[model samples]
Target: MDDIHAPTVASGLSSGIAPRDVSKVSMPDLMQEKERIEAELSALSSVLNSHGVNMNSSLTTFDGFPRDDIDIAQVRTTRVRIIHLRNDHKAVMTHLEKGLHDHFARLQNAPGATSANGTTVPSSAPTSVTDNSIADTGTLGTPFARVNSVEPGSPAHQAGLKMGDSIRGFGSVHWLNHERLSKVAEAVQQNEGRPLTVKVTRKNESGSGTTELDLQLTPRRNWGGRGLLGCHIVPL
Candidate 1:
């Protein structure tokens, strides 16, 4: 004969009996215990979420990195630093662009600056000596030979040739193309004292491509590179 009463978990727990010995605890007591455990779990979940963990991952092992301590001030500092770097970069770029533009403008203006003499400084740009009819005339577009600078005593200078004049026409070639003009200039450059007849034209008016000065002269080893006259000719 055996005592048929089932043991209770609370009595066993209080008595230091293993939970496995629990067989019959009142329904209400079990329900209360379950509710208390659920409440504790809910509180723990809330704490984890505040610390940066996503609450949805609490029940799943696959839930990614658990939330840890969050520092709002650190995040703000990082953002500000990024913005500051971007602004500084923009400012530096703007300054460099302006400087580059100013440098080029100075280069262009240098050609027209005045010299120490009372007379307005002659332009530094190169000149050409030729007639209007390129080829057997004056040719333009020939970089092969350009007027360097007119010498103080030169035939082209007497002919009023200036610096930066381009040969536009040559014997028998009017409106000479670049190729033909280059060929003529090449010949003139080879023979410095050959007394090669040349022509130079200058822009008569600003921005007026059609209007230009027509001067007929000869090639001379002037001040600059192989050009049409004796003075000086520099690249434009």
Candidate 2:
């Protein structure tokens, strides 16, 4: 494992797990923490939106006095927290990137290692890096959505899809052009019964970390389940 040290954010807001702590943790733990921070940031953003303000919105009137329209103190606090979390998010991502490199390096260095005789050697079951998608662990890109549910014995299950997997790419759909997941629907509809390369970042089980995957999902209907994919997804 790599000893990655994340930068600290200076703010009144809690800085989340310390850099030293992260250095000792695995990639999956870091990923979960990243998701937690993102969720909090989303909630705080909603608060600002509810108050009819944004990060760039001025909280002062032309007279330069604090505006009475919104709760200035709460808004300021939320803004600070958001900023701090963003910085923390960046740091965690950096650590994750380094961890990913180290993980691959280990795999490449001794994939199916054998003795000098070169006879067939028995080894431990390949560490289940997370579901059947483990073999498809190279397309780690920016996630646009997250799997919320997956029906058993369904097409999604057959394709190795699992709940909580963050979707990076789905056929022609990606983070920048997902368009509120409308593109996802379009891709699915257009590629029904055909294999679509679905990329995702999945958190490993137990004390392990996270891994990226590229599943070949062939969407169809009436496979002992409702809908084509039999899964629910929500935008991240």
Candidate 3:
């Protein structure tokens, strides 16, 4: 059987083997594996981003595209790596979830386990653990578009848009599967002369944490700008 089809330790024991308990897996080890998979995925995403492509974009062919500017062979290779990395990420996540479940189950079954409030903690007590480190993996309901440039006195400029700022969401354009940035264009055209909310993530000059900005931009033509947005946005 292929490696992909092979049974994993987390998938229970194979034929003629004793079933290994998930509780044997340490939480720290599971967390580390999760972080490693996330890092690999982030690295693959960066490679694709350098080529102006998102993880969701199909790279079937480079015809009529910037083959001269980008390394087509490198892109192809990275695409395959991304597929494998995504699969590995999924598997790791499954293992981590199971480990966490098993750990919490043991905790609840402990002899004298009680809540801080002196109440008996139920086994079904929320096992949900939030990891803030993964919060910036992507924006929710926001499209991540990089501002190429903003025309002076244009709607984008007037709205305080600057180059390098990532548009987390603008009007109806959210980060959910906005690989092509077509939603930003559609939002602009559909909301002309109307106030549109734009959320952006701007890197601080100190190179510390990012700053989130909520700007209201009114899209209009004849603002001495070429496009309705008055700013070039490229998918990141």
Candidate 4:
């Protein structure tokens, strides 16, 4: 994990330049930049986790701690890199929020737009909308992790988890600052062999919408697997 380094933007932007000035850029480009930054952040998080370090943990906790098998210098360097990447990621999100605001503002001022109850309503807005009412039922909460892989005959597999399933909720793990999926790991360790509720979103075959599903998984040792989960859960 020491060899793992912070990933650069997929757009090939050089360092030392402000990367969130996308005011004039099209929506597609803004989205692409957001995706790239998100991927980089996820990669950095995985690197930190591989070293038995939680991304949200304070760096000072490592000071004067045992490091016979770990490179303290590398840990410090990676922590600094993660900080910079987080700032950049936040900037990109801010840019996207501003872009959306500007877009809606334009639509509100567009010709024939109506103001209803002090709220601007676009005239071309759909008269009726279909409600995919799975939020409250299917999903226990907002999705925070994604299942990357599940081992065959493992707890995850027996629980009906598949690759690409977005984990909406697992035990007490919610969407609150779940960039490292550390809460899920903690829950697994504390509730071994106990059934834990898992909520996930699976894409429909037609790719038009998503369907949420609830599953029960029990974590235990000596499962003849590598990890307690027997599956890779990455922050989404």
- Candidate 4, residues 110-207, lDDT tens digits: the string is 87776657665754421111112222322226576789899998899999999999987787565532335755788898999899888888999898
Off-target runs (Cα >4 Å) in candidate 3 are 1-143
Against the hidden true structure, what lDDT does model 2 obtain? 0.74
Model 3 lDDT tens row, 23-96: 45565665455455556667767887998976455444444333355665666556666665566556655666
Which residue pairs show collisions in model 4?
A: none
Q: How many residue pairs clash in each candidate?
A: 52, 2, 4, 0
Clashes of 1: 52
Instruction: Give the least accurate 10-residue stretch of model 1, judged by summed lDDT.
Output: 3-12
Error of 4 at 35 (Å): 14
Among these predictions, the greatest lDDT belongs to 2
How accurate locally, in lDDT, is each candidate? 0.42, 0.74, 0.65, 0.66
How well does each candidate superpose onto the true structure, as a TM-score?
A: 0.26, 0.51, 0.43, 0.45
TM-score of 3: 0.43
The TM-score between candidate 1 and the true structure equals 0.26
The Cα RMSD in angstroms, rounded to one decimal, for candidate 1 relative to the true structure is 37.2
Model 3 poorest 10 in a row by lDDT: 5-14
How displaced is residue 95 in candidate 3, in Å? 19
Highest TM-score, which number? 2
